[model samples]
Target: MHSDPSGSTDRIEKDIVINATRERVWSTLVTFFWVDEGNLGTIDPKAGDRFVAHSAKEGSFPITIEKADHPSLLSYRWASAQEGAEPGEGNSTLVEFTLTERQDGSTLLHVVESGFASLPSAMAERAVSDNTYGWEEQLDALKKSVEG
Candidate 1:
């Protein structure tokens, strides 16, 4: 887990090794990250597709897919601050996930969420702090979901 709430480094990076093949890890990552249990609809992710991630506790957030490279990478832009607002250059952060296959068949999962520096200083700091913790929790769950 790495984050700088001082606005100098406006991104969060997390890496976890899952005891699973890249294919299985990729499947779990795509499914778990994109379609949460509370999500309202299904999505076959691809570049340019738009969707809303509905969280019962946090509310809905609009997301736009930037790139979806099968089994290796997926990147998206999300506006997390305002509920139901569309993702844009000024209001959104880019979230990217990269998967690498290890020689031992375990998968290395890396995630980075950036663009916080563009947001208001207070918002940027809070977002970085919040997401730093969020990613750690989320990745742990993902590892369990894939390994199980």
Candidate 2:
């Protein structure tokens, strides 16, 4: 549902209709995959939890779980690992995942990531490119996880 008007990384969006219930999809988007499956990186799933994951060849960056809405959405600020990183530097993108129930019992999952401009020049481009591919692949994985 994003216009992608600027065609910049600022307007990135990934949406999918999973064959699971809205609640189930929400759980996948929030808890299980992250904590159990190690989706983003190896970090304990907890608010204020912080860890480093080597990404984009930039060593380890920060990952903090800022908020979680069980069975609906989960959001957090991800920090980049490169040196000279600002306090919030390498930290951009308010990523959100929303789940809605469809008429036929399917679940509509919406993913939006904003504020990519905050990343360092090199990492910003790399992040967008990498995530673009990653999201698509993850969607397929999600489908199988829920449908299987």
Candidate 3:
């Protein structure tokens, strides 16, 4: 976990080694929501592409693609649990996925969710705890989705 210099935002990061190629991992990431198999609805994988992710637990939320570099990195900004909230510095967080290919044909998937401290204190703490657990489950699901 890392935080910005002002301590106004905390970053939660997790890494997992998946028994899949980088291409396969990248395809799984940009094409669909890993936590839920729903399509992202015509993602261009370019900056400024807007998409919605539907989760059984979290419902639907908007995401703005911040950066997309094929087979390496994809980042997006999404609102927190607030309903109908727009993604931005106060109400949203940045989610970034970085892929590294290994010599044994496995891919290391790194996920980071940041900007928690920008929310209210209670919300920020809860989000940090919730997202830490959420990412663990999501990463497990990702490994299963690609490996199985």
Highest TM-score model number? 1
| Candidate with more favorable, higher lDDT: 1 or 3 | 3
**Candidate 3 positional error at 5, Å:** 14
TM-score of 1: 0.88
Predictions in order: lDDT: 0.79, 0.62, 0.79
lDDT of 2 at 40: 56
lDDT of 3 at 13: 93
Which window of ten consecutive residues has the lowest lDDT sum in model 1? 34-43
Segments in model 1 whose C-alpha atoms lie over 4 Å from true places: 1-8, 33-35, 38-43
Estimate, for each residue in 6-97, the C-alpha lDDT of model 2 and write its tens digit. Answer: 45566369989888888767655554353234445322355666544443434444556666666676666664324324236445556677
TM-score, per-candidate, Cα-based: 0.88, 0.70, 0.86
Best by the lDDT measure: 3
Tens digit of per-residue lDDT, candidate 3, span 1-148 = 3333444448799999999999998887766666445655325599998767777767777788899999899999887556456687777889999999999999999999988867766667767777888899888987888898
Q: How many Å off is the CA of 113 in candidate 1?
A: 0.7
On TM-score, who's better, 2 or 3?
3
Give the range where candidate 2 is weakest over 10 consecutive residues by summed lDDT.
78-87
User: After superposition, which runs of candidate 3 have C-alpha atoms over 4 Å from their true positions?
Assistant: 1-9, 39-42
Q: What is the C-alpha RMSD of each candidate to the true structure, in Å?
A: 3.6, 5.4, 3.4
Flag clash pairs in model 1. none
